[model samples]
Target: MRITLHEVSKGRAGQALPSMSLEFHSGAVRFALAETEQRPTVLGLIASGRMKPDTGRVTIDDTANPKELRRRIALVDAPDVSDPHPDITLAGVVGEELMFAGVGATPLHARRWLTQLGYNELASTPIGNIDPAARVRILCELAVLRDGVDGVVLVAPDRHGGSPDGWWRIAGEFADRGYAMLVIIGGSAAVALERMQEFEAINASGPVQPLVLEAPADADADADAEPADEDAEPELSAAEPAEAAASGPWVAEAVEAPEPDPLEEEAEALREAQGPASSIEASDTDTDTDTTENGAAR
Candidate 1:
């Protein structure tokens, strides 16, 4: 599969994309998640080929219409489940997707994918009854049907329902089968960084790009603060050494230290000085009470 974007820019409500251009080819999997307001336009370019730039062109295998070109490409968008036929079973929906792409869906392949994705029990259930994660898995399976498959595109927000290991496992499967993937996401930099690291760790040869969506000016301030705010919290693993270093000297110094608060020391001293006077007052009061009782009896 080969993809090329030339100065593709889309605008909405006064903001425009950064006049982006990129390309992806076979034997390489490129990952990018849309951020900012351009997410929809980016997705549109991938899905319907409707968001093409006025000044430039997007070509897939030399075809101008990405959607038409996607016939040879397996495209997976999780939200596209909204268009699933109400009466179609989960397996049926997957079968239809494969069939529409001119691929035959063997029962074995469908069952394997459904079970691997934790959707085995819902294999016969309607698409509407299946959960989002299951839908995502179905889309992933469709992306990589058999070895030597032509092209595949998978798009979803980051933090999809899967453990880190699970995510890497699926990604690895695609890479192993030699399918190019495009991931659309809305998440923090840390999350995106972790994803890129996962891709590199699995296949050192894979191509991945973190496309940060530029938020509005006011929103960018808040987005910029998120990392700093997270950085302020000390990690347990990191703080332990610092704590030990600080404690050693502090403990030694504290051993010889006087009262830290002068007012507390003064109050303690005052209480100690008043102790004898209070005891004498108590004795005098007891004697006066005894004398008063004796006088009353006489």
Candidate 2:
């Protein structure tokens, strides 16, 4: 169960999300930086094959079978999309999700299932009042209940107000069970995860490398066409990434790869549109504080 996003981006220029290229396979958790109110959901939708990117494409196991992606990938807790109502009781939420999973869906069944999970005490509480880590755990548990779901895209768990590590550990647990995991989160959460990464981390975050795009499809012919422009693009070939489908367990060496200039140029434009914002690589957590987001869509 591998998932790849090849330069997959949504919206037009100066809009929701910037171009992103990443890969993650089963038993690994991947994170992407998306701070805006809409970027997280947009990325989740695109990654889960529920929506199409305006530019690039989404693939599972190196094939462009989005329909299969829809079946195998579960998009969890995306606001205004898959999220349960804030006012809904925990039991109500469980019952509804159980219905989707084709299980016993009555209130009693939901309560019994909650008991099995040791969460019966919270059954009468509103889902919005659930702790952030517990919320992620419950939603994800229900998500994997679907027949063919082998992976999960958990969107904006940071918005719920908790230590990023709380939900990160929960996601890692699912990945350890052989489910591919992609968590779309704010820049601050991404920074937190990157900072916690050990030299040889066991719970590694997949594909946090610098942006590296693949060479164009007609590389052989195109390479020869620009012979006169050799000095102008001296480092382009070396900067090309490790093919389009490099999906597997997270590796530190791969994340340290240098990026090409073309993606940097486009990313610069994206930054200008986003105002003064920090990238996921920013070491200072203070830099991710977006006062300007009050004026924007945030």
Candidate 3:
């Protein structure tokens, strides 16, 4: 899915916003610099299709369709539209959003949801006091829970106060997960991010510059990789295990040797109890490797 705002403006005769054009599509996160306290949010609302632009148009996949755009794009942290009440407890916020998401909305369900998101301990904390990056993370997670949401317009996260890298990374992760993301940020925040780009190899994949990793990947693949012939599969199989040795130690450290089935393990333990005692050899495990994974080490 892709969303594009073409010279879109809002408010009295477009005075509220000068025309601005920007585009973001599935598997990408784009940033827009809006300095005013309210323009940042207004831009987000326009980008997400929550509010109609008084001037140009916002389109989904290059077609002018407000309903579809609104359905697919989640307006995250838009002031007065999606922001949670400052005083609401974290659990309360989750419960309310789950209600909107048509999931079970009971407190127990909310607690479980937060636990899975690794925010269980913050359940009782006021949303206002939560860390800014965490606030953006939880809110973005909740926004995606709504059916049909495949994109997010995160508004003014910098206004919450923290390094732009914090929430920027989070947005990049969403994009990596195949969600189209647009982050509306302040001018100073954008400047800071510009300086940050020197030392960090951040995402510049957006048509515009300035993107983050909070899973920022472009699915760049080796187009040059040669496909093996069908008859070569058996030949390749013999060498595959040897090739896997580079990842062996890392994989082992990530995952312990598989346990036997329950009954077998129990029998093995029983046999060990009856067997004579023997000294166990110690092995070094501090080795490191360049192995990488999209999945967990374990």
Candidate 4:
């Protein structure tokens, strides 16, 4: 898959964003780190299929509907558990997402993905009960469920705080699988080096500004921004054994049972109370997590 951007800009709060352009091709992944003040709107555009060059054009090859294009390109970011069910288990969250994506209704696929991404033990644990790193891993699994996905895009504030090494291992696996990925992180030379070791490039952006520096000079300067290196390995540590178990080899277990569908239950209740409406009003809201520039919500 190929993603082409041309002078695409987004407006917010009555301000036109700075024009930006870029291209991402198959077999190559890009890494970018931007401050909250200078993040670009490219990710939002890509996620929403609203990427259009102000002076040129943005074309995606081999895609029909831009909305369905998400199936081929997965965007992973921090978990948003602000909804009513913060106590839902990781497995439950994955199941819900799969069902929403119309992939499958079984937990088996979710279990395998969580395991492959190294979050198997947390499969049955509520999302809010886990630490930040575990939550990030679950987010990654949720973003990239299908095997043949064209690309994976991830946004995070910082990777060094929890387990920098573990992040690299996972990113490396995605690269090895020929999945083009774009990771956004805070300014850190060490993090950039680690990402570039596996990714194709390390770009920069910010929240207030739409400019994206694809080829940043002074690569060493970013390294200075990293915190003092801790004894953390570039792999999962003993502190997170459940994470290890979650990423362990998949084991077939007896299927427990089935549960009631919440949507169906709601529909049933609605019917019981009153006759259903002729048609449900469709929502046009963009559901991509990358809708925001940097960490600031757009």
- Cα lDDT computed for each candidate against the true fold: 0.58, 0.88, 0.84, 0.58
Query: Among these predicted structures, which one has the highest lDDT?
Result: 2
lDDT of 4 by residue, 46-163 (tens): 5335444234445567343665555576656432311215578888888887775568757898888677767788888887677655665566555666554677665552532555
- Model 2: lDDT equals 0.88
Better of 1 and 2 by TM-score: 2
Give model 3's TM-score versus the native structure: 0.66
**1 or 2, greater by lDDT:** 2
- Model 4 residue runs over 4 Å out of place are 12-17, 37-42, 47-57, 62-68, 78-87, 101-118, 128-137, 146-148, 157-160, 189-298
**TM-scores of all predicted structures:** 0.48, 0.66, 0.66, 0.48
Residues 199-246, candidate 3, lDDT per residue (tens digit)? 465445445555764432333344345766664423334557654654
Between the candidate structures 2 and 4, which one is better when assessed by lDDT?
2
Instruction: List per-candidate RMSD values in Å.
Output: 22.7, 42.0, 34.1, 47.6
lDDT of 1 at 290: 43
**lDDT by residue (tens digit), candidate 1, 23-77:** 6666565555456645533554543354556556778777786555545555555
